[model samples]
Target: MLKSGFGPKALLSFACLMAPLSALAQDATSSSPATNEVIGLRANLSPADVRGPLNYEPTKGPLESFFPDCSVDKQMASELSEAFGEALISFDPENKEVRFGVAYKGLSGNAIMAHFHDGAPGVNGPVLQTICGHPPPTSAIGVSATAVMGDKCPVGNHGVLSGTWQLTDHDCPEGSDKSCISRTVDEQVQLLACGNLYVNIHTCLNQPGEVAGQITPVNWIGKEQNCNALPPKSSQ
Candidate 1:
């Protein structure tokens, strides 16, 4: 037998009381809007952060093989640690559009390509987005019209990586290797919010990757010499 207190009126009141609490819980769990702006400061990325026994040579497949490494080429990454770079990324969770502006210099060799990967600061992850130096055909697979991956990069040791990455899915594509992975826009945003995404710039000398930086969300205000800002000219 149902108790009197469990009547429709009492049940309705109980539900009414819980509704507000449920709404409050949802409000607490929702992400803040300010989390959309992400930044990264890279300095001489090292293989110590990579995970694998591939001997610094990518072994994914035909696609990854395009990024070939020479056993005899000078491993400039060993000293490129002195190199510096930074990236400003704007991510819109609603549209899954990612815009990136990056400046890197002092690389040991020419900037071959750049990408965004999934990994922690001290770990290595698969490349989910290509920022530049991609072939024209494959570049359009998940690229945006605002920028072209095949566009020429800056001439010299300094290179600027600018492009848009339209994440498709997080699943690993067939015929691809660990170096490359697929991620949907939602997964990308979640990773950005979790601070698990990083940008990597690969060079001819260090095909494995020369300079890499972990992407983080932050406010650029009150930050001096930020974004790899050059030091002021010394007094003559």
Candidate 2:
């Protein structure tokens, strides 16, 4: 005789359980037609062409006091003759990310901090993001000549002369005012495109800003490209 729990009702229940399993197996083996949803869609509709490597030269003139009492001295400014450096910004609008590599030498004192500040040319503004050198736990300097890139600060001992910053994490200023930071990567991209962003390096000698440079694009001919001269890209 058939088992007590293995009668018609049990067979029906087993069949029911196997139906979905069979369907799942068919689905696992079958190939569906590819969808065309994103096949021809352009990643960035804006023709601003702001996505590329940018160059900057940090000097003394862009320095501005963040504190009322700590102004950069003219004599100290004159002494930054050997304290020159270059910064490179690589922006990826589609990915909503930015990569920065900055290097400097011959600072008046130990490097303390570096940042990308939001401000117009020749004007001082609040720190929009810290690139490196917020010490105690974190090193005040990064490795010299070594390049790092990512959405966060690189791991391990970075020298005091060079470093990188990724815009994905720690891309905002340390303040209550939301206005001090860009709300979106697109906005930051716009700020960069319009020449509204700059890099600042702070030292123990000059807490405000020791060396600063307005970030700007470099053309194919190795010349600075003025963002204002380019016509606005057609809105998407």
Candidate 3:
């Protein structure tokens, strides 16, 4: 006793017709390319200059307990108390590039070398990458160095260092081989994500490592978010 236009077969056909439309709507709501897309670069623009509105991710870690008595170099451990610092790293997986900023203080002597090492917390490992400020005797406590994606030296202070290193770069510790280091950018990224990579700053006193920090993934700051931005004018 159903209407001619609304029989069971007609209802079944109508439901079938609407299934794809419902799925299409759900797909549209769930997909967000902006979040997944890697940050792109404009011609002649440096990675640091390619601000967000683009996908930007940041990772950070702490540097502390770096002493000869710890896991680094006991022979060169200094009596100047413990040194400490923090490391901020950004990676562009699409371009196979990395950017880093490190700030440290309370070293026993002049800063000589700073490097990114492949190791776990409290475990000694090989140097995977050399950051700028090499050849030692760079700066003392309160040191800051930055590294960009294409400069000659990957380390600087108060500014971006203009260099890059590939995942395949054979820049390991003096006696180590590729097998001793993170062999690929993705591998390094995974290490960073899991807090396996660390920053080691060498000092004149402790030629090996005066201080170290394990790199850990952190919340991303928007490209336009001014780290130093003054608080919005007090709307008194």
**Which candidate's lDDT is highest?**
1
TM-score of each: 0.56, 0.45, 0.46
How well is each residue in 180-227 modelled by candidate 3, as lDDT tens digits?
432445455455445555666655355556566665544322333332
Q: Relative to the unseen true structure, what is the C-alpha lDDT of residue 101 in candidate 1, on a scale of 0 to 100?
A: 54
Candidate 2 steric clashes: 4
* lDDT of model number 1: 0.49
- Residue pairs in collision within model 3: 112-136, 112-137, 150-163, 151-162, 151-163
State the C-alpha lDDT per candidate.
0.49, 0.39, 0.40
Give the C-alpha miss distance for residue 99 in model 3, angstroms.
0.9
Residue-by-residue lDDT tens digits, candidate 2, 1-236: 00111123322232443344334323423322132111010011111222221122123333332221124333343444346554544444344444444444555654455666666655555455556533222122211111132122222111222222334422443322332333354455555656666776655455555556777643111123344543332211
Lowest summed-lDDT stretch of 10 residues in model 3? Answer: 49-58
Better of 2 and 3 by TM-score: 3
Angstrom error of the Cα, residue 185, model 2: value is: 1.8
lDDT of 1 by residue, 142-173 (tens): 22222235533344566455545655565654
Where in model 1 is the C-alpha error above 4 Å?
A: 1-31, 34-81, 134-148, 151-153, 178-181, 219-236
Compute the lDDT of residue 229 as modeled in candidate 2.
42
Question: What shift in Å separates residue 195 of candidate 2 from its native position after superposition?
Answer: 1.6
